[model samples]
Target chain A: MDYKTVLTTCTYCGCGCNMYLEVMDGRITGTIPCKTSPINEGKLCIKGWNVHEFVQSPKRLTRPMLRKNGDLTEVTWDEALDFTASRIKSIKEKHGNDSIAFLTSAKVTNEENFLLQKFARAAVGTNNIDHCARL
Target chain B: MIEEIKKQVRELLTSGTIKGFLGLREIDGHIAPYLFCDAEDMDSMNLGDYKKPGDARYPLNRILIHLLSHYPDEILGVLVRGCDQRGLNGLYSLNQLDPEKVIPVGIPCPPELAEACECSRPYPENRAVDGQAEGYSNQTLARIAGLDIGKRFEYWMNEFARCIKCYGCRDICPMCICRECSLECGDLVGKGDIPPENPIFHLIRAVHMADRCVDCGLCAEACPADIPLRTLYKKVADIVKKEFDFQAGYQPDAKSPLNVLDQ
Candidate 1:
């Protein structure tokens, strides 16, 4: 019974097209391009139009997993963060700070990206920081 | 002219004749399709600035169909251009829409837009605002038709090669109403291939547009690849007209020859 359209911006690329995400009962049902948007003018790229598909995709990762006994096993956030920190520390120590690199995603916020680059340069002492959008 | 349409819409809403009026509304200097459920919303209703060339036009009929799917029995009033009226006729013939559940307020396209679209009839048959009809012409279709068989094959190959397999043209088309589209069939169209196997992708869509295309040109407008999709679909419409002596959306009750297998 709860049907509504939430206007938002597309996160796939730099174009930043606006669209309406049709939500029915809290589930993303479809994507409609914002016709009045100054950026897109009611037209959408393929990625912008299919933004809802990934939300409900069964294949999407819901929980963090780590390789244990040569298989991915569900792990708690504390265990996963500790594992990652320890691995990064070992790698940096063994092969120098310059050997470490960080790859960020476009899906995250600008603040999160700033923190990631900061972590790469300040924490890991490496300038090797890049984003997936570049690929 | 827009004032008259708004007045009629307000009357319809206030009299309880229609549950909702689907039309365009201007918000922050941008016009978009909106569902006006209350008489007070009529203050924002805009018939589009016809003086502005190349006005942003959305598929009002497509939005109407989506709304109708949710509220099947409720009567809704929709703003329609000539092409939109034709689309409604085609939908009605196909039994996709219940004629009694809808009302159309017609606004004819201006001469410049009519010529740009090359529309033969730029006004609906009933309750239409006055507008001159422009002769239909498809230079792209004519140019392609003039080419030799080998040249024609090369022309289409080059055109189809630029396709990014976005399916934007299909997604924007108002006449494409099926829940399960054949273009998505894995067997017919191979999976995970960008610019899907040249001729098949374009050909399959062209065939599907045979008796359904209303020459709205929205497909070409939506295509990011700049493919001549409207011309391709127009050719299909021409073929149906020539072969079956039937023009889609011209008559409400007329069934497409392809739909009538009893030929």
Candidate 2:
């Protein structure tokens, strides 16, 4: 009996069309484009219509992974972050700062992307930065 | 028109070519889609003149597609008019509808209905039913084309503002087949607000509809707010044909530009 449309921003791209995820019985059933919003005006392209598929997908990542013997093994955040930092430091030391590049994702928030670039420029000392959109 | 459609459905049911016939039925003084399984059930199959026949064009296409999706081998006969036929063609192009399994019973639209829909051609090119009237024309494109660009934009803005976001247009569209829609793409359109974004939701759809829309007026009918979405998409289709030298449903040999690689 949990039938309600939770208002949320579309995390897909930069246009930011307003919509509601229809939650029925705790299951994301469908989506409805917001009518009162000034941008989209209650119309959705094919993508907006099926925005809930990725959220309920089984393959979405929930935890960090570390590769050992060419196999990725799930690990704690502290272990994963420390491993990443040490690996990056070694890579910079061996190949110079120019060899390391930061590839960002569009799914992350603006603040996270900004932080990633800052880390790449300030900490990593590399201007070779790119985004997921290119690859 | 109602009586003629009923008689044809009755004949088709008795003809034994189809086990079930899908058409419109009267319910509580309104017309809604119904599946006439029994020949006697043709009594309830009401066509038009009931609740203004709000978007009856897409239901037959949906019913046929639904049947094909679940019962791929089963043969179901459908009552198709000009718009419905075009929709069927679009669906067939997308492989959503199986041409061999379903029988199309074409119905010629009357002059008044044609005028109401603002359709260019009211009769389907293919007809299985007998006594269908000649195709009629109501040139909505010419009128829209004659308008200035600014006026047209203002007109579309006002019309789109009345949208209720029921998604009846997308639900009823036969050509729109994607697990995820661009309109829903939060990347392009933001989430959580009424009226959504103005031209983004609609403009994105228009871009997607470039070579797909069959000039069926179901989107306009499905719009609870009576937005003239058909006119806008019709313009888009026109642009596609003008630029790409392509028209949907006119030729089975042709492929929609969106599906093919740019080369």
Candidate 3:
């Protein structure tokens, strides 16, 4: 049994909390906060503590899904991205750019969030942008 | 001190006294709880001192509980500090661990760690280190306890308000070892409520810790919201001490009165 703790940053939020992913036999079984971390100082939120649950979760989506006939159907990444881009373009053309709102998550990195807002404002020409962390 | 503990653990493993030595090891530059089965690899044994003494402490007794279930007949050697020994005592009282099945090699907390933790007892019964630090005073507890009822209510409410509904405090607690927990009950604690229904979520835990909190301060340290949870649990311990004349974690032979149904 190869048991070890891999020190890494929590991917839940922008908090950048350091945690140790307790790997048992090469599978992440638990999460423990890194005590020496200056950022969180060994403290973690509900999300950070349960970070390992998502990696091997049976409910986790391994493939992209698209709604067809009122049901989410598994689709290829290309198909999903193409459908999303086409829909966004059609919506922006039919209605004004302000009609659609782009919402981002705290789970994404600061750089990613910045790019998303930049895309919404410049590419989509809409000021209707918000973040999940606002709540 | 690290060498001293290693020497003891190495002796135990070489002598065939213990099947495995449960302690912390610095593997891959990360200090974590580990079970060393051979004396030759005892070089990686650590006393949980990374940046400071006792900084990388884990619930070894809690891990020991899992170890005992798998290896009931085999004798295991475990590392223990003051808090760990207390945890072992609590486990013993609950029959979660058998004293005869385990050999605990303990070390005393440095003065800085004791002062930082405000640990009442800074060493196990059999201490490997001498002239350790004295336990510090309770300034936070004192300040909160000094407040009147109205102010106290407001103070705790503000602190509890910062709750992200994280179960880190409960999850990190060594005393929390029930198969089922009241905090997780859907009816008692509603689902999808952030910050978890005001004081009820925290109150349930406090009531449960009335006779079990070992004053480890891990709960407070683990809280992302920085809630002074240890103060609340410590108050429960104080109440148990004052009202019941009982303290948990000091003696393994003595069962907590709260756990005893007959009273």
The local distance difference test score of model 2 is: 0.71
Candidate 2 docking class: incorrect
Query: lDDT of candidate 1 vs native?
Result: 0.82
Scored against the true structure, residue B36 in model 3 reaches a CA lDDT of 89
Kindly state the fnat score of candidate 2. Answer: 0.00
TM-score of each: 0.88, 0.61, 0.82
Positional deviation of A16 in candidate 1, in angstroms?
2.0
How many residue-pair clashes does candidate 1 contain? 0
Better of 1 and 2 by TM-score: 1
Residue range A62-114, candidate 1, lDDT tens digits: 88899999999999999999999999999998999988889998887788989
Q: What's the iRMSD of model 3?
A: 2.1
- RMSD, each candidate, Å? 2.9, 13.5, 3.6
Backbone clashes for every candidate come to 0, 42, 1
Better model by TM-score: candidate 1 vs candidate 3? 1
Instruction: Name the weakest run of 10 consecutive residues (lDDT summed) in model 2 chain B.
Output: B49-58
- Output the worst ten-in-a-row residue range by lDDT, candidate 3 chain A: A1-10
